[model samples]
Target: MIAIVARSENGVIGKDGGLPWRCKGDLQFFKRTTMGRKIVVGRTTFEGLPPLKGREIFVLTRKPDAGFEGATAVSNPADVPADAIVCGGAAIYDLMIPQCDQLLVTTVKKEVEGDTFFNFQWLEGFEPEETIEETDEYSVVSYRRSGPSS
Candidate 1:
């Protein structure tokens, strides 16, 4: 599975359940990487979106009127698409990491003062290769299931 989120140094994922930064490239990387694949998210995450395009999203929540017309709702990560991407907010990442094959993380150089931060071990798989990193605030990196693609 592919999971995405922007976390801070303190592991503070959300304050009132919203992202810490406005990383457009990170968001776009998320969309393009997981496009046509299944996407799983929490209710709060769902409520925070601005109508995504061309991707299948499943929400893991227990709210009423639980459906997005074309999207699916489930109880947890396991109920998400087999190879779907578990899109963020820290809650979803915590639940999905053990089962996810890899993670696409956009680590911003500047640490925003926040409550949630990305887990270092999540990127430790296969020796954690730096697929993409720029001289900018955000560094887009990907880790493979088997580590470094050998």
Candidate 2:
């Protein structure tokens, strides 16, 4: 499975329930990587984005009914495909990182204000494989787990 996300240099992924910066290339990269794949996301994260058509969205929520149209609500990561793409808000990222075989991350060059953050230290578990300069403000990096599939 793969985990995809974009965060500021300071590791901020969200502010007031949305991305703190807008990078067009990162947006396009997200679309291309996740297209036609099953995407697992948290309820809050899913609520902020528009419905993705070609991808199946699985939302992790404690609520009995998320009421999100066109998406399935699941309580745990084990309920989805082992190969699903883990898209995020901070909590969901933390929950699913150990299950990820690969990580596709976009690093925004500047620090931005955010209430939610992910500890990028988890990236240490993966070996860096590729880095692409998607834009002047951000870069995309891919990493693969070296020893075992978590």
Tens digit per residue, CA lDDT, model 1, 1-150: 666665544555565567777777767777677777778887887887777778787887765367766678787555677777878766777777667766666665555666556666665553455667554656666666673321
> In model 2, where is the ten-residue run with the lowest total lDDT?
61-70
List candidate 2 segments past 4 Å from native.
none
The residue ranges of model 1 lying beyond 4 angstroms of the native Cα positions read 9-12, 63-65, 121-126, 145-150
Candidate 1 — which pairs collide? 11-115, 11-116, 11-117, 12-115, 12-116, 12-117, 13-116, 126-147
Tens digit of per-residue lDDT, candidate 2, span 52-102: 999998888897476878898998668978878999988888888888889
TM for every model, in the order presented, reads: 0.79, 0.93
